[model samples]
Target: MATRTRRAPPKARTTSGPAFEVDAARLPPLGMPPAEFLRDYWQKRPLLVRNAFPGFVSPIQPEDLAGLACEEAALSRLVAHDAAHDRWMLRHGPFPEEMFPEMPDHDWTLLVQDVDKWDADVAALLAHFGFLPRWRIDDVMVSFAAPGGSVGAHVDQYDVFLLQAQGQRRWQIDASEAMGRTAPPLDFRDDVELRLLQRFNPTHDWVLGPGDMLYLPPGVPHHGVAVDACLTFSVGMRAPSAAELLGDFVDTLAADADDALRYRDPGLAPPKSPGEIDADAMERVVEALNLLRMNDPERLGDWFGRFITVYRSGGQVMPGEDARSRIEVEWDLQQGARLHRHPFSRMAWRKAKRGARLYVNGAGHALPARDAARIADNAVLDGPLYASLSEAGRDRVFELMREGHYHLDLRQDDE
Candidate 1:
């Protein structure tokens, strides 16, 4: 195993600079150095970072979020609380525009998932999360809540960073006990649509203003309520369960498995009881199943690369009716056109013996490791970098672009 090197703490900084730009060396959101945060807090404990984004202003407003909730493709929800009756109601969206005006002034919230895939400004916030693998990120979800609005107390099975974008919200968490093997079994209330905690006892409570942030590890039960109308951005991580991995892995194996392979027992002794399953029969069964086991490391790696790049949701990115030719792409690049990655498409890379395998939206391409890294890390293919690509790399990129993993932006050239 390679040893981790400890470095001096990083100096504090201001707002995350520009869209799709990252300075991995200086991460201000964590309040501590990325390495230290990863070591001491990542998936291990809950942390409250004050003024993580000092003077931060929301790029999108509540009206904008409501507008997005009206779109058919957007995954959204509205949660309303009836305080008088102590009742909670849940409704899924593409809500009509008129629904907002009809809603009660308080005790309601609108939440939109995968806002990063729909809005550039929301996606830009992802650049700040360079400390984690790109594939591990699910999406940036934005929530707009009215005064006294809440989703109820619940425990998430994945890590999350909650950043206050506007106004103020109160957060309470049960941090007296960390979640692990020794932690008590969790119980939920079956009365409501959401999986709310049966009982909640908060050990920490605080109200967050704009620019403040709260980080919670998986299985940490927490609750949040809007102190006033506010907008909050949730950066959530993806954690695939063992069953999900096994199911996908088996599918891949079956796709490439040999049909001719069969169980054989050439030399066998007669059984005293023909109906009974003897020890020898069980041994052969185990031996037969062993043929289906994954023995090659490269094959396993490739399957995992393809599996993770799809994340939880797939088929969001689709090819256009008109496909651009390689020549057209080349001409556009020469004309100062840039290539933008489809926000819904996930990318990741791994080193291979020959070079590296770049995985994008569940597709893999072999390229030089350096080139693979560049493609996986940069969402936009700029003029200089496009010029530097090898013929093979460029060809792969063109194919990917044609398949809708990326699109050409010609506004700059037109200007």
Candidate 2:
């Protein structure tokens, strides 16, 4: 569905603290360095961090989030818990403002996704998690719940960090890892939009306050319920399914293959049983399939860069001016202004045998090896650095700007 946006961007309810520092070296709350955190906890186990963002004030408020839910372009949902029936139900959003006041004060929750794309402060929270690679990130989802509301006991296929922003929420995660996507033993209620577990057993449980956070790896069953009216933010990471990766390879990897070659049986053997496909025919088919295999590093790297960097969100936007002529690009480059990549655009790259493949929003570009490293490492390129680019490299910068992926980093006093 398209986002029903207005003439001006919606201001966040509140902004983050002016001087709340985010250090890339020591990730606070976890009390662990990036290297240690990656080695011990990441993808291996869950980590509970108390006061992850001390004195943290959410940029958007519960009410503002509710307003965004009513926008057709923004993706939102309402989940209501029916404790009497021990079940949960969901309603798709594009909700009306009037529908909220009459809602039951308890047992309900409103969730809005991709908040980072719209709010700058929410986007800043992602920078703190820079310990992980950029391309793997999905989006930020913010939820506001009334007293006793819950999404039920369930496990997610992607990794997520649940950050408590307001009030309190008691969370519980299963100890035995009994719940899984492929294997099922848990009880589920029918006629519900959520795939919620009927019962949950926990080896770990905690009541998180403001700034507290819990990180769970993929396939960990967990449940959370509001102690009172509260808010939570989820930073989810993307992981492609096996089918998706294979589909990319099959559909994309050998698209440039020579179509002129046809299957031939030079060594024809007469078989007594005509029903069976002979070994020679099978060999030819297998050989052809092998030829299309993504075994080569450069070929695979090119495909992977494009595959992972594809943006999948309803609110992605091009920020800069469209139809920018070369003169305009040249003027912008020479103006000595800092350039920034838009938050909605996804970018990634891999070092090829000679140069590197630069991927942005699902498209790939080949550039010199030296420049490729600079592109991968540098998210913000200063004016002097932009001017220093060769003719081809400069043209690439212009293309990104024209596409609205790159532009002047002019942080407005207000969003």
Inter-residue clash pairs, candidate 1: none
Per-residue lDDT tens digits of candidate 2, residues 1-415? 1221122211211222111112222457556677876776677666667668876677888888989899998899999977888666789989999998899999998999998887878888887888888778899999999998888888898889998888888887753432222333467656677887766667556777777788887877888989888889999998889998888778895576778655766777787788988777799998777766767887778878888877364456465655557775556556655667786777777778866778877888888765655665566777677766666677787778778887765443233
Each prediction's TM-score versus the true structure: 0.89, 0.84
Which digits, one per residue and each the tens of the lDDT, describe model 1 over residues 138-193? Answer: 98899999999999889999999999999788888776454222453469988898
lDDT of each: 0.82, 0.74
Give per-residue lDDT, candidate 2, residue 99: 95
Lowest-scoring 10 consecutive residues by lDDT in candidate 2? 4-13
Clashes of each: 0, 3
